[model samples]
Target: MLNFSATVNQTDLRLAIIECGRIAYERHLMTSNDGNISVRMENGQVLITPSGVSKGRLQANDMLVVDLDGRVVSSRPDRKPSSETPMHLEVYKAREDVRAVVHAHPIFATTLTVAGLEFPVDMLPEVLLTLGDVPITEYATPSSHEDAEVIRPFLKTHNAMLLRQHGSLTYGKNLDEALIHLERIEHVSEIFWRAKMLGEVKLVPPEAQAKLLAIRDAYFKR
Candidate 1:
């Protein structure tokens, strides 16, 4: 039998990805093998889910390990890295602080992308503080380096973004953090969609927005 105790961190990382997969599935954020997830491992390797596999049913042994340059270092014998590995690799290159990334087609957020509408931050304090502003990147074919480049600029300031006519990408320091970012994006997207159905939505005043920023800073600092 393989000695798993020696690879505890890698094992934990794999389990984390599997758990994230189930969470995304349970939340209905990913459907029919439509999303990808990845986590950075020590020594510049990245652990990612395989392509075309259902995220909801990932096994710890099914993950692929790749180097920083996107070369496959290890994986289950017959599995392959996600087709979107380039995109995830790009984010990792652009932000050392981002250790995990989640890309999904949550209906509400994807609807805004398809509608060509940017997610407006002014409507909610929590959205602003938790996600900053979710921008819409220019469209690019999935799994292309060009698509990765399109999202590079937004990665510096925003943890989440919509791919024009596509879906959303969220990243953070860990799997849970990335998932929370996705949740926040989906929540705000739902709010925006509902407000549109109800007609005009009012934004919080600028002064109050500033105060909310102050409160967020205080809490983050603590």
Candidate 2:
């Protein structure tokens, strides 16, 4: 499991969830009601965004708490758990270190998926150090049984990925980190897309890439 330097409580987590949902919305990561966010509590209950709710106006009380088995542990009719809860559940099941996840529909990232492109994030030092290779999950119907499975294999090694024909998924030890990745991916995607329009973009040489990765490993060692 991710060892948070500080213990995360339900109230704090709930607040973070609301704040990040707004961040996602304001950043245009998704249409107000398009994505899902979740945080795994210490007690194993999953707290998540509600279905069809506009994240811009989402509140703490508007969240739902569900068990790992996908059963509703605590909920309010005003806010029901998202249909994509299964996808978030699969992520927690696959990685004990992950405490929070952000599913967004950032335009640039989705554009890459639609164009059959994966962000060559390694081309930039900041991106190479913060995020390595960004993967794209196999195409699957959104919120379908296969959707979560399409990304299951990459969970162990990747912190973020593009969901084919869908959008993006980013996970981290907390909502703050998760949101950071959400922003970073979109920013990198835009850079790569804009750069390639002018001419062939240069890649970091293999020798230089190895050194940067070594530095990244040292800084982000789990």
Give the Cα lDDT of each candidate: 0.85, 0.86
Model 2 agreement with the true structure over 1-222: per-residue lDDT tens digits: 122333788888788887888878998997859999999988878999899998888877989999988999888866668989989999999989888998999999999889987778777888888878888989989877787889988999999999997899999888877888889999988888888998898888889989998998999654
Q: Which tens-of-lDDT digit does each residue in 115-201 have in candidate 1?
A: 878787889988756677789999899877777889988878778888877788998878878888888888888999999999998
Using TM-score as the measure, which candidate wins? 2
Clashes of each: 0, 1
Show model 1 residue runs off by greater than 4 Å. 1-8
TM-score per candidate, in order?
0.93, 0.94
Which residue pairs of candidate 1 clash?
none
